[model samples]
Target: MAKKQSNYAYIGIAFSLLVFGIIFIPKIVDRVKVGDITRNESRSKKVLTNSDPVVADLMYLEINGVPKKVPPFSFVNQDGDVITNKDYEGKVYLVEFFFTTCGSICPRMNRNLVQIQNTFSDAEDFGVASFTINPEYDTQKVLKAYADNYRMTNPNWHLMTGDKEAIYALANIGFNIYAGENPNVEDGFEHSGNFALIDKNGFMRSRQDDFGNPKIFYKGIISEEEKEDEDGETQEISMLKADIAKLLKEDLVK
Candidate 1:
């Protein structure tokens, strides 16, 4: 009876092994074949072979069912070169309104922009179009000095200065990014501390807000390191960086 019990135990062990092999063997093989069995296995290999890499798409700002684009305007850059919307064709860039002599927010805004310039230091098709609100004082020379002081190394960065009215119109009417003069303000001028992202096609592009509306302009007043401001508005520098990367990648496919 003891010998028969030992035989029964052997059969039970073999039966369990067969059942395990039937149930789990294909899954183990599949995991190994897909490189999921090893923790150190390269994920890029699987992405390249089996799936499309994930990429985010930016939204086109629209008005009356038509996409808004960067308006056609020419202004002189820091290097005294004519820069227009055409100049930025086939490139991803940011647009901002600022003045060199600003005692308040311009410094912070440009500092944030400089951080972005450094982040995309290697991207050739990335650029910046900085329009000076105080064109009388911020000539090519002043803009050049400002660029130098900030170490603005991006070759495509253009600190522009032109007709004061034209600049104001471009700010207030064209891009709808507010810029105006105010004697009461410490800087003697007041402008929105925002940045607009433009795609290679000259269309102004941006990501949507939580409610699915285009954010339109990114907040340049807040630094990337800061998560939110005193008003509780979330910092968008990181979001801007991500969007810029997405636009640059879009250029790659075309």
Candidate 2:
């Protein structure tokens, strides 16, 4: 009986220590000054991370510096309507890829997107398009449910999926984002977190080539304070939101 009582006492002490550590470890961590840490300009200036100049497929017609045209294809959206590149004409859209079951960066990316949608809820010409990398599982029903789960009711925001081959081709050969099955990757599929911004004329907003030619989708800007959660968006996303407004204004003027 005494031994069992002593064992209980030990357990109680251990639990108390755990609780105490949980209460103060973060405070200790906050005060542990390793040294004077020099931070690079806290503001991330127009740093386009993935935007690069490149051309593949001979049909790669470009305009004013970004890939102006994309391979024609049709995909079903959450509303079950077939959306083709033609639907994107005269509109500016942000496109990206993610699986419904993604447990990593997708959540963060999607959260950023949610803020973006809210930021420009009244804009008719701006849209957000998301493609399911795991089309096999992300069926129309699943996509709709996922969008609904996030309160994504904007008619312009479309979640899509179609022929696996066509989608993969569009991800790789079209958007320049590598989308395919990779046994080495945690999700069994590899893709970029970068979003492609397509402009009103179907040309992707992009950087110019050496001699002045469209080459690739404009790279997004990212900064060091990107991890703040209160703003509900990353620094890069903030930059994107600003750029989207710039493009929308440009469209209105042109």
lDDT of 2 by residue, 37-68 (tens): 33222333224312332232212235444445
The TM-scores, one per candidate, come to: 0.77, 0.64
Per-residue CA lDDT of model 1 for 62-160, tens digit only, reads: 999899988889999999999888888888999999999998889999999999999999999999999999999999999999999999989999999
Q: For candidate 2, what's the RMSD? A: 23.3
TM-score of 1: 0.77
Candidate 2 segments whose C-alpha is farther than 4 A from its true place: 1-67, 207-234, 252-254
- Report the C-alpha displacement of residue 32, candidate 1, in angstroms: 29
Model 2 accuracy (lDDT, Cα):
0.71
Best-matching candidate per TM-score: 1
For model 1, the run of ten residues with the poorest summed lDDT: 47-56
